[model samples]
Target: MTALNSKTITLKQLAKTIDHSLLTPDLNEEDVKAGCELAARYQVASVCVKPWDVRLAAGVLAGTDVKVGTVIGFPHGSSTMETKVFEARKAIEDGAVELDMVINIGAMRSGQYDYVRKEIHEVVEAARGKALVKVILENAYLTKEEIARGSQLVEEAGADFVKTSTGFAPTGATIDDLKLMRESVSEKVKIKAAHGIRTLDSLLEVIDAGATRVGARSTAAMLDEFAARYPDRLG
Candidate 1:
């Protein structure tokens, strides 16, 4: 990865690359609203919330550039393909512009590559071009070969992005995983690095490693650090 000088990247550019996360299980309506508000204020890429909160988040972030995103099958990718498709359709109906769907880790580990690929394809079809689909590989459990294969499956399955982790796994996105994923996918397939990216330096490192977007719960702190370090660049 090439070194990125913080001075060259504007605050807005950095903020735009972040997908502010609000997928915690215990979060209530108030929490979702607050998260949406924060994303709007910060002008981040999107507010990735739970499936049920898509409408509320859309309402809160209305008139702002921040999009409404939701997870399908959530932390665990065990949901049946029908259920995931339903979730994708419902999220889009509820105004979610992006859908981050998890692949069946168990199935992938079991060598059910065709099943995983078909599931992703169905979810993308369910979106019907209304939302961008990001397929999460949950790399914490996969071997390097699996990661590479998953990246190929994502491209073949027509997903817009190949994500590193779901953030609920035992581990999170690593530089090596990001590098491998980048190498595995085609140029058109974007990368999203989620989990364990809490600091500005970490975010930049991943961006330099080939991530076009990120899922972050520490959106405020990181952006604040960027603003403080380059006050003149931030409006």
Candidate 2:
């Protein structure tokens, strides 16, 4: 593993760390298609799209190294576990290789740890090993303690990544939240920072704080700036 914090690595390695986001509700088919093209061009880690666009993105990204991912329970994580599970299966069937599911926020805030944990486990099980599960803590709505607890539940449920936000929240991933989440889970679990990583500086800052993956809307600007600043590392 190239140290996650190391700046001396291939542009492809750094690009692989970004999950290009195209989840805005107003985006239509053309927008998604163009986004997929850009993702392939950059060889991003994945493109997180709305559920309906999963198939489209899957089609566009076929034979490319970039993966397809979609969200479950979305900006708000209040859906029934059953619905989320079904969504997980549907997304996988539609060619999503990664699933970013939000934890039930009300349940978590109520300290319903069992329910939260059970839901995450079921969603993972729903994937049936076909997709990687990234549990969104939606840190914007959580207290520091809740964030820590959420991180624990995500790992306990066997999810691959513990993510910070859904990007619909008032705030997004913060360095403190990333550090805390990184500390909360064992090394087996990865941290994904989303919801405010807009610049190369911010992206690098989050990785240094312990994010192995990030959700970013400013994908081109960040990568272009990176290439400019580190031409020597564009291997």
Candidate 3:
């Protein structure tokens, strides 16, 4: 994998790493349709839908190279490991190519590192070779030590990616968390900065800190603002 740098990759390349999200609880068919259209228009990597919408998202993106991604254990990682594994398998069967599982924050806070690591491993194992697993740290609820420890545990558990936040937390990805995660994992392991990262400055900070992927619903808005301010750059 390539490291984050000032040089921009192609839209196709950028899209390949993005998980275009529409995770609101009140989402409907219309919202999914709009999300799919925007995802295709932006050439985003995947459309991250709710579990029930995975099949719908899969059908909408069937003819395109765009993949389907879904959440497991959702905004909170408080679900039982058994339930999370079941959700992961079911989502893959529903045509999801990527699985973002929320880590059990409660367990981590209790210093049950083994429990946290085991939970991540269960989902990863359940994903089998069918779906890529991204473990969400929900960084806003965690301390620096917790972030570092969780990143390491995620690495040890063999997840494909370690993510910063769920966007529902009090805070989201920070430069410190991204830097710590980057320094903790191997080059092959990917790092994603999500939540509360809506501006170009913050994005650049995380990217510079070594986050290869970013999860943001405001990507389209941010791109529009960028194009307006730097018309020449858009060319």
Candidate 4:
């Protein structure tokens, strides 16, 4: 992964920090295929696709460094805990190496933290050794206190990363949220800021604020910027 708390980066390290997104509902199969190709060419961390497209992404990304990732409970975190676990297992079976699951937003806002913790823990258990679990707090819907608590819950549940928003949220990752999340969890759990982060500068800003991964759609542009600006990193 790229350095999470600094500005320094290499082309590959920068690429490794991006989860190139293709989770939009409007994308057709060909669009996803093309996106997978683009992700491979850019050498990004993974291609985060919808659950249905996991197999396609895995097939295309096989033998390449890019991994297959998909959402669980998706943009909304209303799915039942049992349903989320099943969804996670199914995605893993379909070759998803990473799973970004939305925390039960309503539950967190409702102060049902134990319910939230159990839900995340079950998914983590389901994904154990099979895939990495990243919990999306969907910061747009959470208060600052809720954000910190959610971050702690996610880490306590043994998730691999704590993510900001769902990209469908009204707002996405902010530097303050990133810093708070970083402080809430030990280095053991990394941070992923999604939604509205597109350019290299924005990506670096999040990383500098303690994000270890970022969900992005402009994989090409961001990597291109890195290449142009840091030619020495190419080697």
Using Cα atoms with residue i matched to residue i, what is each candidate's TM-score against the true structure?
0.96, 0.98, 0.92, 0.97
Q: Candidate 1, overall lDDT?
A: 0.92
Pick the lDDT winner: 2
lDDT at position 179, candidate 3: 85
Position 186, candidate 3: lDDT: 84
Compute the lDDT for candidate 3.
0.83
Q: List the residue pairs that clash in candidate 4.
A: none
Off by over 4 Å in 3: 8-12, 226-235
List, residue by residue over 173-196, the lDDT tens digit for candidate 1: 999999999999888799999999
- Lowest summed-lDDT stretch of 10 residues in model 3? 6-15
Residues 27-117, model 4: lDDT tens digits: 9999999999999998889999999999999999999989999999998999999999999999999999999999999999999999999
Candidate 4, position 19, lDDT: 95
lDDT of candidate 4? 0.93
Total backbone collisions for each predicted model: 0, 0, 1, 0
Q: What are the per-residue Cα lDDT tens digits for candidate 3 across 1-235?
A: 4664646643344445567789988989999988988888777778889999999999989888778999999989999999999999999999999999999999999999999999999999898789999999998888889988999999999999999988888888888788888888887688988887677566556777887777878767765565565555543
TM-score winner:
2
lDDT of 3 at 42: 77
Q: Counting only residues 3 or more apart in sequence or on different chains, how many pairs clash (N, Cα, C under 3 Å) in candidate 2?
A: 0
lDDT of each: 0.92, 0.94, 0.83, 0.93
Preferred candidate (TM-score higher): 2 or 4: 2
lDDT of 1 at 108: 94
RMSD of each: 2.0, 0.8, 1.9, 1.3
